[model samples]
Target: MQRPDDVRWPVRVARAVLHAQATGTLIAQYGLVERAWPAALPAVPATRLGVQANCLTDVGVRGMDEAAVFLAEHLKLQGLPEAGEPVERLSAGGWAARHAAGEHSDADFCAVIDAQACFAGAWATARELVSAVLESGGPPRSPGALLYAAVVAGGEANPPVPAAELFALAGKAAAREADALLVDLRLAAYTLKRLSHPPGALGRLAGLVRGTGDAERRHALSPADAATVRALAMNLEALALLKKAAAAVRTLEDNLAENRAGHPESVGETLSIAAYFHYREQDLTRALELIAEAYRLVRRDGAPDRLRGCRKIAVAALHCGGRTAEAEQVQLRMARDPLGFDEEIR
Candidate 1:
């Protein structure tokens, strides 16, 4: 439950590797793992070693071949013979070779494929993998695998299956797996896409959000520790449940203010969402204040998307407050470069 850096070296290294694996940006993930790789040497847990190897393999496929080969050789030197082979194999022959070898569990294979699709943007490969699995009489049943297949089936541009049917199948699988959270959250999101503010779905989603926030508090996890609260807030916003969304945002802001959460990106996003909420409520002054703080936090890391989001909220609030010229300037700056503005809006 401690922060990644607050832990002992081994745990810190593992946490960093896991965090890298979860990161949305491949470059950032690769950098984090590359830096943590040295610290993971000699005697880390076998599980962590395997995870690091897998991560390096993923990065290598995405164009960081040197790191992958280096990690494989380093693991071999550490006498982790079992750990190095998969990296070497994956690097040399890729996921197909691994699948042919029949060594990986179905769950592991599905996870790797899912990562390829979600993180590496290999949708075609994902579809291929899913088809192969199905043809082999093994339709993905694990929650992660099912979720991935569902997303791919539903989200693609062309014809394969109806989005609604796939989502319903996924929801059922999630329910059977006792993953109440996923079922509720996934179904709520899917339903939202189909219908605007269905009362029953919104009610369920609101409860899920409240329940998750409560669970986080009970476990002493800062609402900002995971993306759960932030995601819940976004879902609420999508449902037009502003009051509940604002409550979730306040939890994130309070955790950030108390120094309980260290992720500035997450806090920045929550703030931006809150700013939009205030903007919707016609509190232009509060909207500007919140978005200014959000912009400041996001600019430190050059998060262009978050910066763009903050800019939109700030520009709207400024324009609505009779500062059209300032809004135009902000819009122009964002158009030039989302992260070019050095000064946060006041």
Candidate 2:
């Protein structure tokens, strides 16, 4: 929001998540999410803070805000750093809307500080407790947000923090937290593997893409998870981790195909990511197709800013495809928006 520069921490967190989810277009005007983190994060696929916030929110609701309360109390007790004044946590309905669907009854809601030592920097203790969470699970949900938090908090590295610890943390989380939207698991694993062992990660992603052809899973990723794919792919692309990025983009595209029936936002967002990847590869034909598809989705969804951004991309793609007059017409359309800011582009 506000051009990214003017935003504060949580909103900054939100912006980062949105950019990761599918560039700045998906949540350009609204449809943002922030989960509690070091403070919190908005609901965009690429946001670790959102995962963390959502994690705490999930565990809390599973136990009726008990887990979340303990986290706050644990932070206070350990004097772990936090920002902003403490605010009341959301109710279960609110959490369910943000996280995966759950059916935790009132009895499931209780405060348990058993992970206090784990959360408070007792490494062995924390790791063991996390293992217990993995072992003692019912249905899939993101229960590893706190562990991810601990790993991030513990690692302070100009020389790069010991990645083994991160691997251990993410590895465990990824196993049990199969909730698609709880992308903290995959994000952490991808970041770690992408940075340290690119080839292996690439292979793993390729397999994941191949595996999506199966019937049970069917590549039906929630919009949030797909955005996470987009975000991580962007990161990999930036690092010149081309193979891994390609795999991620493929996964994202497949996800879009499976779930595009009723969700225009996902369609528009993933199309943008796909279009950018194609544009980078100089596949102007596919890129223009993607841009046009995304523009239609954005307009159908009634998002002016998103439509404006889509038109901009169309102009670029049209110019690159040697269709200069078409690009000019798209530019003229931008000038006609209510804001009139695009008039200056002329």
Candidate 3:
């Protein structure tokens, strides 16, 4: 199949983001090696977590296409043999085979993992892949990558390892390969993210926050790193005390231009956070406006989940604002649009 031009950069990025997240979820649910290497991921203690392959059904086959594109793009960007490339596909069986061939360097691995970790959906599966990578014997090509994989792996394993413990382990293992301070800072960022979400690792996040600010303030992150930090912050908002989470959201918005130039996903996230906050505060009018903004962005980009979320919020906001006619129209349109009715994508 022919690939679309990148002229639609924002939509492409958003699609890529969605694809990566969905792929991660698939890995977490079904176990990455389950179909191919049934005993692999499951044999690991972390396999105790049930990762239903069925979850991908909702995201649909496009999710897999996006995943393939993501891996292909990463491989090309890293100068590794992309499995999707005809010659490379024959040689590597595809991108995964090329990756397994040890042709990738530390920087290559770092770039891949960094891109992979940007989505929440990818968190669990990425963690498993990283853990397995850590146990793989080699002179440790990429310490930063190793540290990242270790942190993610620890998050899903049966024992449910603490980010801190993983941080320490990563520090000890990768210290000689990279600067301990840098490693610590990166570790701190992921720790903060893990704490900010459903499982709520507040204590760890709190401990990491102070020192992380010190390090990050002094260092400039790559554009990709900036995006990852923002995504992590979004996840963090849920786990943080309301006040702190609110403040973080504000900071994320303040720094929007840094990450938003060509990335609608980041922008949509900002809008979603703003909308969610306003909704919770009962400022339904403002929430409605922001949700509308979010819907506009996602709809243009083919991101159904964002649109669905915005639609739900907008309906509530319209009701609060007593704009019954507009609310009804929105509902009617939603019911009529086949794309809008994809509850699975929602």
Candidate 4:
């Protein structure tokens, strides 16, 4: 089918391919994609579209022939290409066949459509991941890793492709996909905390509080999970509030004493929170100080996760604070996982 004008399927396709790896659990976790399809695509199913609606259900996940039929019909309606012709056929094999037979004379059109299918597949994968992570129950694996997997898959799926010259070839997609992407990020943060408790738990709590405005469901957790849920929520609020107060001191410089007093901490987390604030404000010096204090406190307390988190903040603070030499040295010994870079980490 011809892509929508506003969708930009080329980019979407790239992102989808990158995110497909994490889709299985994401789909099972989330249960369903927030808003699956647009109103215009009546032919597309919310729960099932024969085999074409791979994102909705596993109705035809294994039937490529059925998928081809749907594609052929979609192509016929769009009038962009057809099944037997190189431009019209719907399979990876068909694409090869057309290319080999010289039936697809327009290389540009062939490239665009193939890219769209690949992206659609990736998007399907992400949706699947979201659904999986949110599901009520599953294996005992940490939720954080699943979430990280989703982000990793997502970033990998949509690697930037320089296609400014081929603007017309970009197939547009529904805004729902972008919305879905953000939701996935939020979910990733929640899952990450699940992987590692207390601090990771704290981060997840913070996310829930900050993300309340954008939550898809009013009641995401069950009544039985109340204690855990409250812990997650409160932890996020505390961290976020502490971070904000610290930022006020650095940026406004007027709120330092006031924020610090309100965010009193006997443990070293207060310092870490301060560092978080300064880092956001770009006040690397102050951030480094707080991070150091936090690291010391965490080490004494014997909470490796919190300690590791503080160390990470310290490294980043040093790097941004113009202590490039120190930051480089610190980076060499750190765990250095890319999962930390996921948008949800914000």
Best by TM-score: 1
Q: How big is the positional error of residue 200 in model 3, measured in Å on the Cα after superposition?
A: 7.5
Q: What lDDT is obtained when candidate 1 is compared to the true structure?
A: 0.49
Regions of model 4 farther than 4 Å from truth = 1-235, 238-266, 333-346
Rank by TM-score, highest first: 1, 3, 2, 4
Q: List residue ranges in candidate 1 displaced over 4 A.
A: 1-136, 153-179, 194-197, 206-238, 242-266, 299-303, 339-346
Which 10-residue span in candidate 1 carries the lowest summed lDDT? 55-64
Report the Cα lDDT for residue 116, model 1: 41
What are the C-alpha RMSDs, in order, of all predicted structures? 11.9, 14.2, 13.1, 19.3
* Candidate 3 wrongly placed segments (more than 4 Å): 1-128, 139-141, 147-209, 212-239, 243-267, 298-303, 322-325, 328-346
User: What local lDDT score does residue 86 receive in model 4, on the 0 to 100 scale?
Assistant: 22
Angstrom error at residue 52, model 1: 14
TM-score of each: 0.52, 0.39, 0.46, 0.27
Q: Residues 191-292, candidate 4, lDDT per residue (tens digit)?
A: 333232335534544554444433324454333233323323333444434535543344323323433444333225445655777788787777777776
Query: In candidate 1, what are the lDDT values of residues 124-181, reduced to their tens digit?
Result: 4445555555445445565555655555554343425454455556557653322445
**lDDT winner between candidates 1 and 4:** 1
Q: 1 or 2: which has the higher TM-score?
A: 1
Q: Model 2: how far is 161 from its true place, Å? A: 4.8
TM-score of model number 1? 0.52
Error of 1 at 330 (Å): 1.8
